[model samples]
Target: MLSTKVAADTTPSTRNYDDNVAVDTKKKVDRARGNITQRRCLIDNIWNAHVVDYAHVYEADGKKDGLISKLERSWNVKSGTLNSNTRRNIFRLSAKLHRLFDEEKWLLLPETKIVDQYYEHYREAGYADEFPVIKDLSFNYTLVAHPDMRQVAIHRRVEGVDINTPGAFKTFIYPFDTFPVIVSHVHPCFVICNSGQKLKDYDKIVAFRKGDTDQRKKRIARIQSFSKRLDGW
Candidate 1:
């Protein structure tokens, strides 16, 4: 059961991307023409994903006419003619738009929220009831301060999170290649969640498709060649 207190509501919440290097540094390494998805309008044009694994397809709206109307109106799906997709488009563009309106405040951004439940075995100690094992958390994301200080917000329904109790659970939320992923606990040797949990001391995950089995198989040639070179040395 969720409740919204209309009287104390002071903020408009929406999705905000959390790429914080101050600009878009991530690039598509092997972009294809046919599989690509490009969304265009008057004010913005964005190239979404033809293929993605660690990342997702991006979106935007470059239409200039909506700017004036956006500041004054709460434009979203279910208004009338505008579809749900357009409402979503506005949310993505909000980062750049809000930056312009606020004169660039980095802290105004909100990151995705995630919750986790971690349990320890009490059976060894002969206990029947479970102890504290759930964590509730939300991280606020801010761009490093360029390209209009990108802002994004997302909330995930964690199993057992009570806003009333602070610091009962551990949470992590960070921007991974511009997309925000929230996860709990860092596993060094274990596989990280494919959903985008960048653990501390983590390395980048390459996007690949098993459907392109031949492409991946071809990479083995490079590895074999390198081994031959080592043998020659």
Candidate 2:
């Protein structure tokens, strides 16, 4: 899971993107539309939109590291959202939205309060046990700072873990792309957690429909091509 906290800064400068950059990014998107997924398109838009700075915090040899190292190491998913692909997508979308909002400076102080209330409600409802780490889960409110200084982006990585394997540490959260912009008040543009978790074995039921190895390879190739095109933009 991911969240962004936006605060006012004393800096007077603002970042802007060139019109040509957006035009070129759209061209790349159009070229890849025949072969890529909507998710990939969303990623492309986020990447070319602005300059983003990222920071990661995770456990290394039993020690915490990154901007959020002091926070708890364990994370819990809602009872049913544990499927590898589903979880991965949630992480990706959350990071993407964070970057998009940052780029536009459409961040509201109330949004941070809403995120805080969410966790408080979860704990008061006796859902802490659902995520074992919640008992010790404490957020460093001081970590929330002006985006210009440290554009906060966090992902909890488990060292030596294979992301493809179920229950692996890396599977807890995935890294995502971002862009930069100034901070300003805006109404909430998106909401998280509307999607429900799976109650059954997601992999066993969905794997068959995903296609064969050759098809998978082609999809990967297309994504790589799209990424390369964006690099040029």
Candidate 3:
């Protein structure tokens, strides 16, 4: 009888949750997993995300004329401030993505296997994509408090070093202290990806596309042009 009772207890039955709120919460959590939002520019196809924000979502006034009002939606991704950990996550994701691409290229897997192999290799290598898979993964970090300015991911690794912990497998890496060093660099990108990170300092960033001296001159010229236009109006 005990044996029979144990067997019955061990048998599993399909059970479902009835609470709608609980279900919805779980779903929402699932959705916001990895959505780290930051404005960035592609430097050498590697993204440089400056966590500092300088953007304002613009709005238009009512009673605009037809021609001017006809202008479609306009927006801008302004630069903003950032903190250290957030910068770490952002650069880490980017570097991992690039690293995966490199590994994939080296693997030369048949096209048929690319899809299956892509993610597997990504896990084995690292997740630098920074794309949040669900709500649970959402860290909700913002600029100004995070990375504050000059953090970056560097992937240049040492020569002849074999990675066993997925260590410097790709360029963008940090303490990821969990993985073994041998596993870090993987195989193809096994150069023990070296990274040098400097925090974002306004003077250091050179974020402005125009060089320093040139930028000042350009700004003066632009103001002059705008002033003349306003005067004509």
Candidate 4:
């Protein structure tokens, strides 16, 4: 009789209000597990737009825009303002996507070659300023903030030789700190990929492209729909 009573109380129909909310939340969480798809969509939006712009510039005057120059043009950021972290993420993501999608050589120095050759040169130099500032190696280095460099060096295992042989550079470079390496070199005159039109339809992301008033309204409505539930949460 006790076991029967326990089973009856534990049934979904007889579960308490908190249990119902918990079950509902769990179901929603489970269904919301497409974060990777969402992130890919986000990155693809930026990438496809850039590729389209690249193709347009190329077709207009036979001029291929450097990736960073294109970004600076679009974003209105000053040159050399991009930190090492942002540059690193862009390089890694672009390289990964290129591998996955078989993107043609947009960069003058291929991503693998840049990582292997130019990036290794600065990293092994054992100093922040030792990172190159050349045009072809733009992807390899950036101005790292002193605080960030110090924080990274904290966990790094320092050697007596590393400390004794250098200036303040040793205070920054340590054995374990990767310090945000870069990927590909974007040459000034490199050829642009001509797949911008194809990339527009590649991921069906064009449906969510910027400047669609109706789609934007629908997205806002979806957000507001859940935002109303925040009070309950």
Q: Give the top-scoring candidate (lDDT).
A: 4
Ranking by TM-score: 2, 4, 1, 3
As a whole number from 0 to 100, the lDDT of residue 53 in candidate 1 is 14
Error of 2 at 224 (Å): 36
Locate the minimum summed-lDDT window of 10 residues in model 1.
186-195
Q: What is the lDDT of residue 71 in candidate 1?
A: 19
Which ten-residue region of model 4 has the weakest summed lDDT? 1-10
The digit string of per-residue lDDT tens for model 4 on 129-152 reads 333333443333211121212233
lDDT of 2 by residue, 1-233 (tens): 33222211211123222221233333433343222222222222222224322201110121112211211211333332221111111111234444443432212111234344444534365322333222211121111122332343433333356656663432111112123121211111111111101101344213221332444223323323322322232
Identify the superior model by lDDT, candidate 2 or candidate 3: 2
Which of 1 and 4 is the better model by lDDT? 4
Candidate 2 C-alpha error for residue 15, in Å: 26
Residue runs of model 2 more than 4 Å from their true location after superposition = 1-117, 122-127, 130-233
Residue pairs of candidate 4 with colliding backbone atoms? none
TM-score of every model?
0.16, 0.20, 0.16, 0.17
Q: Deviation in angstroms for 52 in model 1?
A: 26
TM-score computed on alpha carbons, candidate 1: 0.16
lDDT of 1 by residue, 110-131 (tens): 1211111111122232221342
How high is the CA lDDT of each candidate model? 0.22, 0.25, 0.22, 0.26
